[model samples]
Target: MPLLLLVCFTLLLPPSLTAQQRPTTDGPSDPPARNWYHQLGGSVGWARNGNNDFGPAVALGIGAYYHHLRQFGGLVAGAGMGFELMNADREERLASLTALAEYQLGKRALRPLLRLSGGVALPVGSPGQSLDSRRAGALLHPSVGLLLLPPSGQWGAMVLDLGYRFTRVDFAAADNRGGSFEREVSYRRLTLGIATRF
Candidate 1:
Protein backbone atom coordinates (compact mmCIF):
# COMPACT_ATOMS: atom_id res chain seq x y z
CA MET A 1 0.00 0.00 0.00
CA PRO A 2 0.96 3.61 -0.61
CA LEU A 3 0.60 4.37 3.08
CA LEU A 4 3.22 1.74 3.91
CA LEU A 5 5.72 3.24 1.49
CA LEU A 6 5.23 6.69 2.97
CA VAL A 7 6.02 5.41 6.43
CA CYS A 8 9.21 3.80 5.21
CA PHE A 9 10.37 7.03 3.58
CA THR A 10 9.68 9.01 6.71
CA LEU A 11 11.87 6.65 8.70
CA LEU A 12 14.79 6.26 6.32
CA LEU A 13 14.98 9.71 4.82
CA PRO A 14 17.16 12.59 5.91
CA PRO A 15 15.87 15.42 8.05
CA SER A 16 14.12 18.12 6.06
CA LEU A 17 11.70 19.48 8.62
CA THR A 18 12.71 22.91 9.85
CA ALA A 19 12.22 21.84 13.45
CA GLN A 20 15.21 19.47 13.34
CA GLN A 21 18.52 21.25 13.51
CA ARG A 22 20.83 21.15 10.51
CA PRO A 23 24.50 20.83 11.36
CA THR A 24 25.61 24.39 11.98
CA THR A 25 28.94 25.71 10.67
CA ASP A 26 29.34 22.39 8.87
CA GLY A 27 32.04 19.73 9.59
CA PRO A 28 29.91 18.08 12.30
CA SER A 29 31.22 20.56 14.81
CA ASP A 30 27.84 21.87 15.98
CA PRO A 31 26.03 18.75 17.17
CA PRO A 32 27.22 17.20 20.43
CA ALA A 33 29.65 14.30 20.01
CA ARG A 34 28.15 11.40 21.99
CA ASN A 35 27.48 9.32 18.87
CA TRP A 36 27.00 5.74 19.97
CA TYR A 37 25.53 3.71 22.81
CA HIS A 38 23.44 0.73 23.87
CA GLN A 39 19.76 1.00 24.70
CA LEU A 40 17.12 -1.19 26.35
CA GLY A 41 13.34 -0.91 26.27
CA GLY A 42 10.15 -2.62 27.34
CA SER A 43 6.58 -2.13 26.15
CA VAL A 44 3.02 -3.26 26.71
CA GLY A 45 0.20 -2.95 24.23
CA TRP A 46 -2.88 -4.28 22.50
CA ALA A 47 -3.14 -6.40 19.36
CA ARG A 48 -6.05 -7.32 17.15
CA ASN A 49 -6.11 -10.50 15.15
CA GLY A 50 -8.55 -10.34 12.21
CA ASN A 51 -11.55 -8.05 11.80
CA ASN A 52 -13.91 -10.97 12.31
CA ASP A 53 -11.82 -13.12 14.59
CA PHE A 54 -9.97 -12.52 17.85
CA GLY A 55 -10.82 -8.85 17.63
CA PRO A 56 -8.57 -7.84 20.53
CA ALA A 57 -5.66 -9.27 22.49
CA VAL A 58 -2.64 -8.49 24.67
CA ALA A 59 0.95 -8.04 23.47
CA LEU A 60 4.23 -7.41 25.27
CA GLY A 61 7.90 -7.18 24.38
CA ILE A 62 11.42 -6.21 25.50
CA GLY A 63 14.48 -5.35 23.44
CA ALA A 64 18.14 -4.39 23.47
CA TYR A 65 19.72 -2.31 20.70
CA TYR A 66 22.96 -0.77 19.58
CA HIS A 67 22.45 2.83 18.42
CA HIS A 68 24.54 5.00 16.19
CA LEU A 69 23.53 8.63 16.30
CA ARG A 70 25.87 9.45 13.47
CA GLN A 71 25.28 6.51 11.23
CA PHE A 72 26.37 7.04 7.61
CA GLY A 73 28.10 10.27 8.54
CA GLY A 74 25.11 11.65 10.47
CA LEU A 75 22.02 9.53 10.04
CA VAL A 76 20.66 7.83 13.14
CA ALA A 77 20.43 4.04 12.96
CA GLY A 78 19.84 1.19 15.37
CA ALA A 79 19.86 -2.59 15.23
CA GLY A 80 18.79 -5.13 17.82
CA MET A 81 17.15 -8.38 18.75
CA GLY A 82 14.08 -8.91 20.90
CA PHE A 83 11.22 -11.08 21.92
CA GLU A 84 7.46 -10.57 21.61
CA LEU A 85 4.69 -12.42 23.39
CA MET A 86 1.03 -12.26 22.51
CA ASN A 87 -2.31 -13.94 22.73
CA ALA A 88 -4.60 -13.63 19.72
CA ASP A 89 -7.49 -15.28 21.49
CA ARG A 90 -8.13 -17.68 24.33
CA GLU A 91 -6.90 -20.63 22.33
CA GLU A 92 -3.62 -19.23 20.99
CA ARG A 93 -0.56 -17.91 22.81
CA LEU A 94 2.53 -17.10 20.79
CA ALA A 95 6.09 -15.94 21.37
CA SER A 96 8.59 -14.67 18.82
CA LEU A 97 12.30 -13.96 18.54
CA THR A 98 12.98 -11.14 16.09
CA ALA A 99 15.78 -9.10 14.58
CA LEU A 100 15.05 -5.35 14.51
CA ALA A 101 16.52 -2.45 12.59
CA GLU A 102 15.53 1.20 12.67
CA TYR A 103 16.42 4.58 11.22
CA GLN A 104 15.53 7.88 12.81
CA LEU A 105 15.17 11.49 11.69
CA GLY A 106 15.60 14.22 14.24
CA LYS A 107 17.96 16.56 16.06
CA ARG A 108 15.65 17.80 18.75
CA ALA A 109 14.33 16.07 21.83
CA LEU A 110 11.44 14.69 19.83
CA ARG A 111 12.08 12.61 16.71
CA PRO A 112 10.44 10.16 14.31
CA LEU A 113 11.62 6.55 14.27
CA LEU A 114 10.85 3.81 11.73
CA ARG A 115 11.57 0.16 12.31
CA LEU A 116 11.23 -3.27 10.67
CA SER A 117 11.41 -6.67 12.34
CA GLY A 118 11.48 -10.25 11.09
CA GLY A 119 11.76 -13.64 12.72
CA VAL A 120 9.94 -16.81 13.72
CA ALA A 121 7.36 -17.57 16.37
CA LEU A 122 5.64 -20.52 17.90
CA PRO A 123 2.78 -21.28 20.20
CA VAL A 124 3.79 -21.31 23.86
CA GLY A 125 0.52 -22.41 25.33
CA SER A 126 -3.19 -22.86 24.57
CA PRO A 127 -5.77 -25.60 24.25
CA GLY A 128 -4.79 -27.83 21.33
CA GLN A 129 -1.79 -25.59 20.69
CA SER A 130 1.52 -26.72 22.12
CA LEU A 131 5.03 -27.48 20.93
CA ASP A 132 3.91 -30.94 19.92
CA SER A 133 0.78 -29.82 18.16
CA ARG A 134 2.01 -26.72 16.39
CA ARG A 135 4.79 -25.59 14.06
CA ALA A 136 6.81 -22.40 14.25
CA GLY A 137 5.99 -19.77 11.65
CA ALA A 138 7.39 -16.59 10.16
CA LEU A 139 6.76 -13.16 11.67
CA LEU A 140 7.02 -9.74 10.08
CA HIS A 141 6.30 -6.37 11.66
CA PRO A 142 6.82 -2.76 10.66
CA SER A 143 6.32 0.20 12.98
CA VAL A 144 6.54 3.97 13.04
CA GLY A 145 6.98 5.78 16.32
CA LEU A 146 8.12 8.88 18.12
CA LEU A 147 11.13 8.79 20.43
CA LEU A 148 11.21 11.60 22.99
CA LEU A 149 14.56 12.13 24.62
CA PRO A 150 15.82 14.67 27.07
CA PRO A 151 18.79 16.98 26.57
CA SER A 152 22.13 15.61 25.32
CA GLY A 153 23.23 14.17 28.67
CA GLN A 154 19.96 12.52 29.53
CA TRP A 155 19.80 8.74 29.69
CA GLY A 156 16.18 7.95 29.09
CA ALA A 157 13.34 8.40 26.58
CA MET A 158 9.64 7.83 26.22
CA VAL A 159 8.30 6.12 23.11
CA LEU A 160 4.92 5.67 21.49
CA ASP A 161 4.51 3.28 18.56
CA LEU A 162 1.92 2.10 16.08
CA GLY A 163 2.43 -0.74 13.62
CA TYR A 164 1.21 -3.88 11.91
CA ARG A 165 2.26 -7.48 12.54
CA PHE A 166 1.66 -10.52 10.33
CA THR A 167 2.24 -14.15 11.24
CA ARG A 168 1.54 -17.67 9.96
CA VAL A 169 1.47 -20.76 12.16
CA ASP A 170 0.26 -24.25 11.51
CA PHE A 171 -1.43 -26.71 13.81
CA ALA A 172 -2.39 -30.34 13.54
CA ALA A 173 -5.17 -32.34 15.17
CA ALA A 174 -4.35 -33.59 18.64
CA ASP A 175 -4.83 -37.14 17.51
CA ASN A 176 -3.50 -36.56 13.97
CA ARG A 177 -6.88 -37.60 12.64
CA GLY A 178 -7.18 -34.34 10.67
CA GLY A 179 -4.58 -32.79 8.40
CA SER A 180 -2.53 -29.76 9.43
CA PHE A 181 -3.72 -26.26 8.58
CA GLU A 182 -2.18 -22.81 8.57
CA ARG A 183 -3.46 -19.78 10.42
CA GLU A 184 -2.46 -16.43 9.03
CA VAL A 185 -3.00 -13.70 11.57
CA SER A 186 -2.54 -9.98 11.12
CA TYR A 187 -2.63 -7.36 13.85
CA ARG A 188 -2.79 -3.63 14.36
CA ARG A 189 -0.48 -2.81 17.28
CA LEU A 190 -0.24 0.20 19.59
CA THR A 191 2.25 0.39 22.46
CA LEU A 192 3.86 2.71 24.97
CA GLY A 193 7.27 2.20 26.50
CA ILE A 194 10.46 3.63 27.90
CA ALA A 195 14.06 3.32 26.76
CA THR A 196 17.28 3.96 28.58
CA ARG A 197 20.84 4.23 27.36
CA PHE A 198 23.71 2.36 28.96
Candidate 2:
Protein backbone atom coordinates (compact mmCIF):
# COMPACT_ATOMS: atom_id res chain seq x y z
CA MET A 1 0.00 0.00 0.00
CA PRO A 2 2.87 2.33 -0.96
CA LEU A 3 4.56 1.91 2.38
CA LEU A 4 1.33 2.64 4.27
CA LEU A 5 0.76 5.86 2.29
CA LEU A 6 4.21 7.27 3.08
CA VAL A 7 3.68 7.15 6.86
CA CYS A 8 0.44 9.21 6.71
CA PHE A 9 2.07 11.94 4.60
CA THR A 10 4.96 12.43 6.96
CA LEU A 11 2.62 13.04 9.94
CA LEU A 12 0.68 15.80 8.14
CA LEU A 13 3.71 17.99 7.43
CA PRO A 14 4.66 19.23 10.96
CA PRO A 15 1.10 20.08 12.01
CA SER A 16 0.60 22.05 8.82
CA LEU A 17 3.67 24.16 9.38
CA THR A 18 2.72 24.95 12.99
CA ALA A 19 -0.70 26.23 11.87
CA GLN A 20 0.93 28.69 9.52
CA GLN A 21 2.98 30.43 12.25
CA ARG A 22 -0.06 31.42 14.36
CA PRO A 23 -0.07 34.79 16.29
CA THR A 24 -3.27 35.58 14.38
CA THR A 25 -1.45 35.43 11.07
CA ASP A 26 0.99 38.32 11.76
CA GLY A 27 -1.39 40.87 13.42
CA PRO A 28 -1.52 44.69 12.94
CA SER A 29 -4.20 46.56 10.92
CA ASP A 30 -7.34 48.04 12.50
CA PRO A 31 -8.43 51.49 11.31
CA PRO A 32 -5.90 54.33 11.62
CA ALA A 33 -5.66 56.96 8.83
CA ARG A 34 -5.97 60.38 10.48
CA ASN A 35 -9.19 62.23 9.67
CA TRP A 36 -9.58 63.88 13.09
CA TYR A 37 -13.27 64.38 12.41
CA HIS A 38 -12.89 66.19 9.09
CA GLN A 39 -10.56 69.15 9.64
CA LEU A 40 -11.44 72.79 8.70
CA GLY A 41 -10.37 76.16 10.13
CA GLY A 42 -10.30 79.90 9.46
CA SER A 43 -11.05 82.90 11.69
CA VAL A 44 -10.16 86.41 12.93
CA GLY A 45 -11.66 88.46 15.78
CA TRP A 46 -11.38 91.57 18.07
CA ALA A 47 -13.88 93.73 19.99
CA ARG A 48 -14.48 96.11 22.88
CA ASN A 49 -17.06 98.60 24.18
CA GLY A 50 -16.58 100.16 27.64
CA ASN A 51 -19.78 102.18 28.05
CA ASN A 52 -18.15 105.24 29.64
CA ASP A 53 -15.00 106.91 30.97
CA PHE A 54 -14.68 108.34 27.48
CA GLY A 55 -16.23 108.23 24.02
CA PRO A 56 -15.50 105.63 21.30
CA ALA A 57 -15.45 103.25 24.26
CA VAL A 58 -13.58 100.75 22.15
CA ALA A 59 -13.63 99.37 18.63
CA LEU A 60 -11.19 97.66 16.26
CA GLY A 61 -11.88 95.06 13.59
CA ILE A 62 -10.74 92.67 10.91
CA GLY A 63 -12.60 89.49 9.94
CA ALA A 64 -12.99 86.56 7.57
CA TYR A 65 -13.74 82.97 8.55
CA TYR A 66 -15.21 79.56 7.80
CA HIS A 67 -15.45 76.30 9.83
CA HIS A 68 -17.60 73.26 9.20
CA LEU A 69 -16.53 69.82 10.26
CA ARG A 70 -18.63 67.69 12.53
CA GLN A 71 -21.24 65.32 11.32
CA PHE A 72 -22.58 64.92 14.84
CA GLY A 73 -20.82 65.38 18.17
CA GLY A 74 -18.86 68.55 18.71
CA LEU A 75 -20.79 70.59 16.15
CA VAL A 76 -19.66 73.73 14.25
CA ALA A 77 -21.07 76.43 11.98
CA GLY A 78 -19.61 79.88 11.15
CA ALA A 79 -19.68 83.19 9.30
CA GLY A 80 -17.91 86.59 9.77
CA MET A 81 -17.06 90.14 8.75
CA GLY A 82 -15.92 93.04 10.90
CA PHE A 83 -14.44 96.39 9.85
CA GLU A 84 -14.43 98.85 12.72
CA LEU A 85 -12.52 101.96 13.66
CA MET A 86 -14.39 104.06 16.14
CA ASN A 87 -11.93 106.48 17.70
CA ALA A 88 -13.81 109.12 19.62
CA ASP A 89 -13.29 112.84 19.03
CA ARG A 90 -15.50 112.56 15.95
CA GLU A 91 -13.58 109.91 14.05
CA GLU A 92 -16.31 107.33 13.62
CA ARG A 93 -15.87 104.55 11.11
CA LEU A 94 -17.79 101.31 11.54
CA ALA A 95 -18.71 98.25 9.57
CA SER A 96 -19.73 94.97 11.14
CA LEU A 97 -21.45 91.97 9.64
CA THR A 98 -21.52 88.52 11.13
CA ALA A 99 -23.36 85.21 11.46
CA LEU A 100 -22.24 82.29 13.54
CA ALA A 101 -23.24 79.02 15.22
CA GLU A 102 -20.95 76.71 17.09
CA TYR A 103 -20.53 74.03 19.73
CA GLN A 104 -17.34 72.09 20.31
CA LEU A 105 -15.99 69.86 23.00
CA GLY A 106 -13.37 67.91 21.13
CA LYS A 107 -11.52 68.17 24.42
CA ARG A 108 -7.98 69.50 24.89
CA ALA A 109 -5.58 71.61 22.86
CA LEU A 110 -7.74 74.68 23.32
CA ARG A 111 -11.05 74.34 21.49
CA PRO A 112 -14.06 75.99 23.08
CA LEU A 113 -16.62 77.91 21.09
CA LEU A 114 -20.27 78.93 21.53
CA ARG A 115 -21.46 81.81 19.38
CA LEU A 116 -24.36 83.67 17.69
CA SER A 117 -24.18 86.95 15.69
CA GLY A 118 -26.24 89.41 13.68
CA GLY A 119 -25.03 92.33 11.55
CA VAL A 120 -25.52 95.77 10.08
CA ALA A 121 -23.66 99.00 10.98
CA LEU A 122 -22.43 101.48 8.44
CA PRO A 123 -21.13 105.02 8.83
CA VAL A 124 -18.04 106.36 7.14
CA GLY A 125 -16.64 109.84 6.40
CA SER A 126 -19.62 111.86 7.52
CA PRO A 127 -21.56 114.05 5.06
CA GLY A 128 -24.71 113.88 2.91
CA GLN A 129 -26.77 115.39 5.70
CA SER A 130 -24.57 113.44 8.10
CA LEU A 131 -25.83 110.28 6.40
CA ASP A 132 -29.45 111.01 7.24
CA SER A 133 -28.71 112.29 10.72
CA ARG A 134 -26.03 109.75 11.54
CA ARG A 135 -27.97 106.64 10.67
CA ALA A 136 -26.94 103.47 12.56
CA GLY A 137 -29.12 100.41 12.24
CA ALA A 138 -29.39 96.67 12.28
CA LEU A 139 -26.85 95.51 14.84
CA LEU A 140 -27.33 92.57 17.15
CA HIS A 141 -24.55 90.33 18.33
CA PRO A 142 -23.94 87.38 20.62
CA SER A 143 -20.63 85.64 21.14
CA VAL A 144 -18.06 83.46 22.81
CA GLY A 145 -14.93 82.01 21.25
CA LEU A 146 -11.64 80.17 21.46
CA LEU A 147 -10.58 77.82 18.69
CA LEU A 148 -7.04 77.06 17.78
CA LEU A 149 -6.45 74.15 15.45
CA PRO A 150 -3.56 71.79 14.85
CA PRO A 151 -4.48 68.66 16.70
CA SER A 152 -3.87 66.80 13.47
CA GLY A 153 -3.29 69.44 10.80
CA GLN A 154 -4.91 70.01 7.38
CA TRP A 155 -4.87 73.81 7.41
CA GLY A 156 -4.08 76.56 9.92
CA ALA A 157 -6.55 78.18 12.34
CA MET A 158 -6.82 80.53 15.31
CA VAL A 159 -9.74 82.43 16.80
CA LEU A 160 -10.42 84.36 19.98
CA ASP A 161 -13.56 86.43 20.30
CA LEU A 162 -15.90 88.15 22.75
CA GLY A 163 -18.75 90.28 21.43
CA TYR A 164 -21.82 92.40 22.20
CA ARG A 165 -23.30 95.22 20.10
CA PHE A 166 -26.46 97.33 19.95
CA THR A 167 -26.59 100.65 18.14
CA ARG A 168 -29.36 103.05 17.12
CA VAL A 169 -28.87 106.67 16.05
CA ASP A 170 -30.91 109.67 14.92
CA PHE A 171 -28.98 112.89 15.61
CA ALA A 172 -29.96 116.47 16.55
CA ALA A 173 -30.04 116.17 20.34
CA ALA A 174 -31.46 119.70 20.89
CA ASP A 175 -33.26 122.58 19.16
CA ASN A 176 -35.56 124.63 21.43
CA ARG A 177 -36.26 127.89 23.36
CA GLY A 178 -38.72 128.53 20.47
CA GLY A 179 -37.74 125.88 17.86
CA SER A 180 -38.88 122.36 18.68
CA PHE A 181 -36.88 119.15 18.10
CA GLU A 182 -35.77 116.47 20.53
CA ARG A 183 -32.68 114.24 20.49
CA GLU A 184 -31.73 110.59 20.21
CA VAL A 185 -28.39 108.75 19.98
CA SER A 186 -27.33 105.31 21.12
CA TYR A 187 -24.31 103.15 20.35
CA ARG A 188 -22.86 100.25 22.15
CA ARG A 189 -19.97 97.81 21.85
CA LEU A 190 -17.94 95.17 23.68
CA THR A 191 -15.46 93.15 21.73
CA LEU A 192 -12.05 91.48 21.95
CA GLY A 193 -10.37 89.76 19.04
CA ILE A 194 -7.87 87.58 17.17
CA ALA A 195 -8.42 85.44 14.09
CA THR A 196 -6.53 83.61 11.40
CA ARG A 197 -7.18 80.54 9.27
CA PHE A 198 -6.58 79.15 5.85
Identify the leading candidate in terms of TM-score. Answer: 1
Colliding pairs, model 1 = none
Instruction: State the C-alpha lDDT per candidate.
Output: 0.54, 0.46
- For residues 73-179, what per-residue lDDT tens digits would candidate 1 score against the true structure? 32445555444455543355666666666666545445666767677776665555543566778877677776565444434555555666666676543434555
In model 1, where do residues sit more than 4 Å from their true spots? 1-39, 42-85, 88-91, 126-129, 173-198
Cα deviation of 120, candidate 2, in Å: 14
Residue by residue across 1-198, what tens digits does model 2's lDDT show?
Answer: 322343343334453232223333222211123323322222233335556667544544333333333323455544455555444444455555555556654343344566566656655433312332445567675656666544333345566656655555444322325443433434555656565544
